[model samples]
Target: MTFSIVGRCEETGQLGIAISSSSIAVGARCPWVRAGVGVVATQNVTLPALGPQILDLMERAKLGASAALDRALCASEWSEYRQVTVVDAQGRTAFLSGKQALGTYHAVAGKQCVAAGNMLAGTHVIEAMIPAFENAPGHLADRLLAAVHAAIGAGGEAGPVHSAALKIAGEQSWPLVDLRVDWSDDDPIAKLDGLWQAYRPQMQDYVARALNPTAAPRYGVPGDE
Candidate 1:
């Protein structure tokens, strides 16, 4: 089972997704984002390919969130078993929870975000995330994480979650923030938050290093100065 949020930062035009699941390596399969395009989270009998297909439609075909999703689903032979969510750079959102969706599934859309979960503790788990995302401060990654925390507080999935991921696409083609906890006996969300905190401070520095190495910050390791 999986619970996820696909979001856009109106302030920065960044797209991202935060997700957690009872399955392992949830990051490797679900949650896809393209800078200046959109984000798609494909779960519930997860067809990993559907994620990229949706993104391709949005990026290359210049399709909006709903159109891209519709076309992608039409192409998917196993669409009925999938639960997917999408949010474009313009903040348009769409989602589908199939008739065959797992127990107690729910999906909700908010200002610039969509939260969804299958085999959840209750629909309230999905409901609680919307306000959290709208109100959270700091970066888009922080807001997305806040939504995930709210879902957990509202009683996340019907079962324990073993893996979690946070992905954000900025100006570059690559992810601005990509963090994952593949498997954890302890609290994976908490572990993911810790990783975010550690990465946040150095996020822009890494980007500068890639774009203009001479202007980038120092590595700060021994002898680097």
Candidate 2:
């Protein structure tokens, strides 16, 4: 049903996730990340609860990503139907693909990243994502976008992807940058890329405001004037 990558940027310390799926609203269903906590992408049968549950456990103590994922998998009723990838605050990464997952579900875990997907054309789909992220130059968000693009080129989901998203968090739980293409007639991944490009300027502006509200007026708002 979906393919996703969850990771942290070694350069920026920004935690994020990028996902695409044949299902509608894949962004809402597949990807979740909490900056300074961890990232989770729950696919296949898709246990949405595992997203926050894993993060909560990691927050309670400084557990490694694998330990947290193991604990969560043990507690879930649908463990056999779920595929999850997690990267904790310390940059440790982990992934689990259930035996009962749909066709070709797989995962790759690296020191700084994890890529996972189900219903893919082949195992190389997830493998391509890792090097794409590593070779991509720029911020965490850009690298995530590259990973998604790589997966798409590697044959993507077994079916057409309808939705995609990218999420990044910081000191606050609220996403610093969250962009989604819920449904698209065009290439959803490309649509997501365009939206991300358009949104980056606005996102930067918003972060600038948050850092220095007094400078808001300079950007042409009424208060700054």
Candidate 3:
């Protein structure tokens, strides 16, 4: 069982996906993003490759989120069992809950964002996320965090969630933020959020180190000094 929000920041042009699930390592299998392209979450009976396939359609084939999703599903033999969401660079959104989606499932689309889930407590889980994302402040990552928290507060999955992930794509080819709590007996979402707070301050430093090492700041750790 899984739930996710895929979004694009209109102001910063950042793209990201935040997800949590009863399954372990949900992050590695469900969320995918491209900095200047789009974000995708493939859950339920997850076909992880669908994430990149949708992105390829959006980026190389010049397709929008809806068209890309359609094309991706058209090629999938297991589309009937998948729950997927997409948010394009331009903030256009699309999502699908297949006929075979487990338990309770729903999807909600807001400005520049889409929230979707399968095997959820109820539709309220997704309904609560859109408004939270729309009104939340700070970076795209912050808004995504708000959405994830709101979903949990409203009523999360049908069962306890053991894993969570927050992934964001910015100017770099690699993810600007890729945090995951692969499995936790307690609250994985809270742990994932804590990781975000710890990572946020060093985010820019890491980016600078990659882009221009000569101008980047020192690590300030024992050996780096």
Clashing residue pairs in candidate 2 (N, C-alpha, C atoms within 3 angstroms): 217-224
Identify the candidate with maximal TM-score. Answer: 3
Q: How well does candidate 2 match the true structure in TM-score terms?
A: 0.93
All models: lDDT?
Answer: 0.95, 0.86, 0.95
Which residue pairs show backbone clashes in model 3? none
Looking at model 2, report the run of 10 residues with the lowest lDDT sum: 215-224
Each model's number of backbone clashes? 0, 1, 0
Better of 1 and 2 by lDDT: 1
- The model with the greater TM-score, 1 or 2, is 1
Candidate 3 differs from the real structure by a C-alpha RMSD in angstroms, to one decimal, of: 0.8
What is candidate 3's lDDT per residue for 137-185, written digit by digit as tens? 9999899999999999998999999999999999999999999999998
Q: Give me the runs in candidate 3 sitting further than 4 Å from their true place.
A: none
The predicted structure with the larger lDDT, 2 or 3, is 3
Q: Candidate 2: misplaced stretches above 4 Å?
A: 217-225
Question: For candidate 2, lDDT tens digit of each residue in 63-106?
Answer: 78889899989998978888999998889988888889999888
lDDT of predicted model 2: 0.86
Backbone clash pairs in model 2 (N, Cα, C under 3 Å; residues 3+ apart or in different chains), count? 1
Roughly what TM-score does model 3 have, to 2 decimal places? Answer: 0.98
